[model samples]
Target: MLWGRIYFGVQAAAGAAWWIAVAVSPFVREVTLGGLDPVAVAAADIPLFVVGSALAASGVRPAVWVATGWTLVVAIALAVYATVTTEAGWGALVMATAAVASVLALCLVLTGRVPTAWLIAGPFSFRPALPRRIAAAHLVSTGAQIVVFWGFFLVVVPLVITSLENRWSVTLPFPSFVPVVGAVVLVLASGLGLWSGVTMSVVGNGTPLPAAMANRLVIAGPYRFIRNPMAVAGFLQGAAVGLLLSSWLVVAYGVLGAVLWNHAIRPHEEADLEKRFGDDFRRYRDTVRCWVPAISR
Candidate 1:
């Protein structure tokens, strides 16, 4: 695909540039690995340069697989080390940007085509389980997911982005009412999310994760009015968090999530639903709007 090729090209260029910088530039060495010896830093980045070049040159399956694994490892290592050890600075920004780019490149490589079937097997499987078991699974999964989401998105990401903004001397001032409004929206959105989770667990007999999605078609509660209340609430919550933090990057991240979900995820999900439920899903989809909440016929 065009996008996959583009990403591969960019990754190759970036990998080569990084290696060259580390070899020749003391500043790059200091910034990349917290003042690691230039020799070691250069050696560490050799794999990055090699894998990227091989993948770009060959465009073969083995090269692609190797590049994917290398990039994933690099991304995870940079993210973990930077978040844990580094203070807010150019180093942090550089590492964060590289990590994000690596992740994007991975996604592009893995999902070469539009409307990937990645979520098909995970969410579409449904076996009839007792209501109590369903509730337990829902509670456990939902709680764990909530912790992971809030810890990463609301706490860690906002902190990093806001620190960068401050370092760059970019200020966005809003009225006192902004935080108040954000707080209200956050609360309301969280409430809606919880209600939607409960409804899914009780009525649909499943949790929200695609791997453990509700077995029954969920049209009760918020799903009755909106096709995707959880998604709506998530967007709202993310935006509200950005508002509270006064971080434009965080707000953009939230918007990006919505865009990705709408374009990449929703199609496969609805397609799976249509395939599984056939006319029932088609009728529900025809009656209920995707974004707007209204009385369903």
Candidate 2:
């Protein structure tokens, strides 16, 4: 729900800024979408997005459906216009990123995998399930999650970032063996990620998703050495992929993900764990560092 609200708020704010730029700003007004003036289109976005934001804040489900459809159509239209106009730069990159984000958001909403309420709410907690039932279902659920996570993060996002880098002719030179080294790192990181996922499934009785969080405070496998092995593996894998692709932007993206995850998601996760497990989690947290492995044992 917090994320949902942020999405809607950004849309509303962006719509207003876009309108202001296209309407009265002389430099922006000179810009064209496929040789056509975007004045009317810009004018339409602000009110629509503002209303949608209001509706979302009120927890109206229908508003999300409508706003998502509207956003998707606009994104597609702009992307088509950019392609037709031979626009290849930051504008094109922004459009592509927005289009992908809109599509992913729509998919999440449609699948009902996320919480329904869009309004501000208390911290979410997943319903408890029998450990046996969760363990039994872990293989299927965790497998599906792995596929989705890999497809979206490793494939889709990298493709988009690489497109931006290619358009800007950005390249960072590296040794010939860099890719080989990256491959080795990728394999190691993947192994750690998989080991962590399996441990979460079997020992902790849950998936990696916060919505289906573990029942037990697992201290097995990679968890015993590092507090957030999965996160470490994910960051390493992203950086390795950037090295393999030879895209500096993708490497920076990996760094950005680590910062955001640490600041935005980590605190919430730790607070929730402490609330549930009390001193046990605090002790585990104090003993095990987040990014580094314990070596003096």
Candidate 3:
């Protein structure tokens, strides 16, 4: 576990230190590589890296070796780029992070500890242990979610507003990168969505998909506080994207989508759940709020 511990530990520390260095710098907003901001990139990445580091540190699997190695490479590349391009520089903290990450990567890789399957699959393959059919289904469902919801609805449509003349559509102007307000919303919603997916797999013994729904009831994680955490996350994500892009039409679509789900889709899904789960579903549903979280529940 020496390779896993020291290597991934450096990666985790580097990710954190880079963020800190960027945040405290005078040109915080100017810390972009291309057109993309590192905050958003870090927001997506830090969680996965942290999880990988934790697993590696605990010697859970050899997957962390690959994760750490890849992360180290990325950190080094970014550091090199920052050193070359920026006038302000990455500072002493980030320089130390880069140095440590490089050394760790060499140590992990040179020792022949990196697993091939982990390189091919990932540091954390969610469906690798599942049956082929289940894995395929999960991939299809996840692909649809990324393509339809995240790529098309959240990104493409919102970006369209940039070319238009009118700035306002029908948006409520919510969930922007405005201080901690939007960050908090994004973090909570993303956490809930991830929690629901993980809960479906673990507690319910299946992936989160209507077509291949969980066989058993999943009352763990966010499901303990709210019945439909994924839906809540979806709504928040959509709204956040709209607000971030200054597109009222996108926000309107989000609000309308929520309404449709509540009125049209929810009842049918609930009925199906009731049929499948019987009194257990009823009791849980009765205790848990559909939209809002009751933290104590």
Candidate 4:
């Protein structure tokens, strides 16, 4: 449980760091791709990122408390930044909505007292314990994720940005000066998402499923709400990337990601689950919606 807590805390902090980067990319020199002057905006985001990074490194219960506080702070900062920087009237509203949703989701992870039953860490936790076949599958899935994102960002997005008119202008409905929204969203989502996945993996680690990797089927905490909450959240994170870069190609990549998960990954995972848990897996599947929680049991 201590390991789990530590892992979760670090993940949260890393995520917060990412969010801070996104919220204040204008201020952060490294984040500025080129041509956009975001000195004031990045300046505003620096402290938040620093604080979040510090808290994540601390790795104590106190750190958890700090993470919780920072999550709220990041949200507020993003909201304020959005209101100030947006030239489009509707853009402010959209940014505000996204900010609120992002914050709410972050809060859910930061503050919620997830049961210890779902927390675990160490080399033997999940990754090491994965069976050969299932491990291969996971590798393939992870590789696919990388290929899609990198291919789009490096090759496809640049072409679109060069060819299309007002390409850079096509950002999330946030303040122009605060282009860090997407980056922040990705950071936050990745941090929390990994924390959740690790926790689930720990809990289910030792149990042997018919499928080796399937043994790490977590049914508690975030998983209790949705069968593929992690995947869904990951999609949202991808969307944030598209929004941050204001690239149609990136956004399209995100959409393609959803399709890949739904059509390719989910079915394979479910088949494995059925093989492992049998009737229990079916019962759970029947109760839980794939991505949407509102329809879940």
Each model's Cα RMSD: 5.9, 7.9, 18.9, 17.3
In candidate 2, position 76 carries an lDDT of 68
Error (Å) of candidate 1 at residue 182 is 2.4
Which candidate should be chosen as best, given lDDT against the real structure? Answer: 2
Instruction: Flag regions of model 3 displaced more than 4 Å.
Output: 1-148, 161-180
Q: Which segments of model 1 are wrong by more than 4 Å?
A: 14-47, 50-77, 80-178, 198-221, 245-265, 292-297
Indicate the residue-level lDDT of 283 in model 2. 96
Per-candidate TM vs. native?
0.61, 0.61, 0.48, 0.41
Candidate 3 C-alpha lDDT tens digits along 1-297: 376466666566665665676568646535334334667866755665655555555554554654556556656655455444442222322333444554445455446443223322332222222433354455555546545556666677667643321321112444445535545666777777776776766666566656556667889888888899888888887776655555555566678779767865677678778988899999998899998899877
- What is the C-alpha local distance difference test score of each model? 0.69, 0.70, 0.60, 0.51
* Candidates arranged by TM-score, highest first: 1, 2, 3, 4
Per-residue lDDT of candidate 1, residues 134-222 (tens digit): 47677776678777776787678878777756654344677777778888999999999888888888788877767667778898899
Candidate 2 lowest-lDDT run of ten: 114-123
Candidate 4: global Cα-lDDT?
A: 0.51
Return whichever of 3 and 4 wins on TM-score. 3
- Model 1 reaches what TM-score against the true structure? 0.61
Model 2, 1-297: lDDT tens digits are 545655666766665676666567655544433345565765665545556655654557677777666666766665555555544233444555655555445445446344323311242444333466647598667778888988799879988878756654345687888888888999999999999999988988887876777889989999999999989899988988988887777888888889767865787678878998999999999999998899653
